[model samples]
Target: MHSDRRVVLEVKDVSKLYRLGNIGTGTLSHDLNRWWHKVRGKADPYAKVGTINDRTEIGDSRYVWALQDINFKVYEGDVLGVVGRNGAGKSTLLKVLSRITSPTTGTLGYNGRLAALLEVGTGFHPELTGRENIYLNGAIMGMSRKAVSARLDEIVDFSGCAKYIDTPVKRYSSGMIVRLGFSVAAHLDTDILVVDEVLAVGDADFQSKCIGKMNDVSKSGKTVLFVSHNLAMIRQLCNRCIYLENGRLHSEGDTDLILGHYLTKNSDTARTFEHGPIRKVEVIPETESIRLKCHYKVDRIVHIPNLGFVVNNQFGSSVFGNNTLNSGMSANREFPAEGVIEVEIKSPKLVVGKYTVSIWFGDGQEDFFHEPDCVEFELIQKSTSQFAGSAKVGSVLTDCEFKISAL
Candidate 1:
């Protein structure tokens, strides 16, 4: 469907480099070296020497590549989602695309005006009133005074800050600031919108409103680039996604495919788990039942550890959960030093979709170990099932028997 749409934004071989310790090259010698290379019309002497942006390891080089040879295109009306761990360079990629900072290599091509809400109060002056800042932002986007005035009421109403529209922005709370900033960006006359994780500051209702507005914007043939750690929101808002790892685009495709890959990979390495007794967790999803195999190693002896698990859907909502105590297991005996626990949940009645498992080991008195999103799996409906190929009605299927009685 997107094949015929015009490309609104193009990023070709884009990369961003940063020095480790200080803003500039620490030594005059390095500065001189860079100048000499530039004077001779040569490539940056240190551009190719930086390490990838991995925060866990102590690197040997002082230069790191926040973005490396990134390439992608945003078609008109596309809502592209960017996902990654903290140091995976997601923010850097957004900043580069938003033109907040220039790439060290390659170029960006834009066919339309761009407006970004990268940070809270990104273009707002602290001393200016909320009412004035809206006009200021419109001016920055090249809108005329009359044009901004025409949309002023809509912006203030959408922000839910009409009561304090004339208050100085410096006095506004963080949530207020985000509301006004997002309102201005979304209401102003712009063809492309670039939003980072700043929307997380707003309340839940406002976030929902913002998502609805973005959806409207896309339907009108505008483009959007969104970055957030909230996988659930990404799944809901974006039709396509890109995963970044170590300053490079690791994968890009359909939203569900990328999210599945990310969850499975992170679980396999236990990267999201805290150091504890739980070593590994495996989940097997079936039409009739769900199987869980947990591996654990205990260093200190504790009175009877109760093993439990909770199954949650992609939206982070708990579909169902249980612990050993509730399953008629005795809690009088002590836990083994190292062992595996296997659990089979019969007739789970889960609807077709993806789910994640969170495991916890704890004594009746105190908690010992816990891991969230330790494993992820999907459930497929059988061909003979009544609800096969039907639209999802709820998170779980029910076995209700239908009958009618005459009153």
Candidate 2:
């Protein structure tokens, strides 16, 4: 992939401005001004002024720049990972690249056909059958009927939805629709693929399959722009990464370095309430399961506060967790001003990786204290598997034994 690489896509100063307000034709004066600017070959007055896209704050201008000064060059056979917090304009960037929407400013130059899976069912008509949608997508991509017919069997087999191929896509589940949609995008004759959080909707096996497919595509001298919150998948599939923050390109370059910066930025920021103050949290590994102990100070005497913990993998996806009430256990004990609570997870079946723990102190209905990143630990197996560290499919590794018998 590294040999004889050339730039396949170039995005220069791309910015998308969205006006916030009622959706309708603007006042007559504004429309005339826009037309006048177009006649004079001048920039639209509205494009010059816009606030940063911060949903939490109110700006003087009704317009917001969803993307600002975003520039990147993607080379042939490069798997570029785009990552950021929610509302970071990752999807907007992809939409612009896919030509589903045009940027308010700047230009994009690229070579070859581009295919995107922006959402679960972006191109499909709900009333159409799965089989019909495949053909429709091919037509939309400007492919001949013969071309799509040749690949129909491969698409159907990859989707694992042959049984429902003739059924209306509206009846299919989200996961099934994603499988069918991804299979089409992957098998199409496109030089570049833009995918947005496709693994977020798929099952563990399906996610593994999709990652493998993307890997194969990269190997075939194609470009991929992947946007995902799943850092593990990004690290696995992407050779380059771009981090966007507040609708702007914050950092771009190596994958591991950028991911490290992202994790550090989101490490510690949890809301606290009047219920209690958690002093410290620790996760200790044991032979069977891990032990999570919380040392806290209770300000006032409160009835059994529900104590729970959530474990998130390095990709920032919640893997496994349990609350006392949900687990059929009640901690209705009176709390002193200061105390320690220890919860032991039985058979913690997590794959070997670095994981962050988020602890919660709630009163059944409301959260008293929430710590997003209370502790971090690595899960290591005492013994390696027979395959010697083959990529684990998902975050959890269930306990089971395999046996073979003659039929």
Candidate 3:
């Protein structure tokens, strides 16, 4: 991967910073001031930045660094997946590479025709019909009219919008618009393609087509930079991936391993709770024969914030669990000390896997649990059977049978 096979893009220490100020002349003044400093051969006063989480006030000038000290290189034919939480700067990074916006600091160097499907039909002409927009978008991406015409039928068919190929894109549904837009970009004879998660389009079949198209693009020696929240898709589409957190590169590695780390590290349940004492509790499992019995000693009045648990597989991710306070029947009962409390979760549709559980008591919204330790459980195969001895057969168990009611 490190070999010098026409390294197209080299982004070194790239940073994009935006300033905050009262609108109008104040913003004008700040921009002029920064420019004036540059003319004097002196360094820009804003060149140095403070910490990421630095505090600011109404009167004090503030800034946000969308991309911070980032560094990565894309070789020809590499498909790189960029993953992060919202506001993690994944989109900002793509914009920088696509040249839609410039970095506040650092540099990006690349050699190739780079086209981005950032937002659906971003460069489309609302006044034009679908047929017209195709040529227009192609030209905008540095493609000649001849190229667009050559791929016209494929684009229209790929979008499954051929019936509406002559219709104005403005009247097209968002999903249709996305399909057409991606179809255009995918066919562009570009060396690199930058895509942000605009694939929530068409249907499941169309989504699979787009993913397969990207797979083909990488196979054809064209580079791709894909950004998406769906880790499953990222694992399948990319061999290498970059994880961004708080506007900086957090991790980069094999797609599966990197996404696995990113998903857990930045997951919603990544916080610890603080709570005290539990009242009445209910234990529920889908398994009809299985039962859970619990005992609690309440010495004083205390609030149990949230009950939390983790579902883990021997190799990787299973599930992360949390109970909404007072969720379901848990809110209706109270537990007194020195008594056995039995709880039943009827027909829990749990997938076959190992599970860990933790019960907590604290403030409102699961601030903390009774103790830091979690309870554990295991679920073995039951109604499970294997097909040719390969594919998974059952997801969850249910005592289900059927007979022909009518012919």
Per-model TM-score, in order, reads 0.76, 0.71, 0.69
Report the lDDT tens digits of candidate 3 across residue range 34-55.
8898899765566564335222
After aligning candidate 1 to the native by TM-score, how far in Å is the CA of 151 from where it should be? 0.7
lDDT of each: 0.84, 0.83, 0.69
Worst 10 residues of 1 by lDDT: 382-391
- Cα deviation of 268, candidate 2, in Å: 1.4
Q: At residue 6, give the lDDT of candidate 3.
A: 84
Highest lDDT: which candidate? 1
Kindly list the per-residue Cα lDDT of model 2 for residues 214-279, writing each as its tens digit. 999999999899998767677777889999888899998888888777766654422333445677
Candidate 1 lDDT tens digits, 1-407: 77899999998999999998867677888889989999999988888789988888988888999999899888999999998889999888988888888899989999999999999889999999999999898898899999999999999999999999999999999999999999999989889999999999987678879888999999999988999876767877888899999899899988888877776665442323346888778886645788888888888876667889999987899989998777757354455788877899999877666688888887766778877887787554333252322325678777789899999
Ranking of candidates on TM-score, top first = 1, 2, 3
Off by over 4 Å in 1: 268-280, 284-290, 294-342, 346-407
Q: After superposition, how far is residue 61 of candidate 2 from its true place, in Å?
A: 1.7
- Weakest 10 consecutive residues, lDDT, candidate 2? 381-390
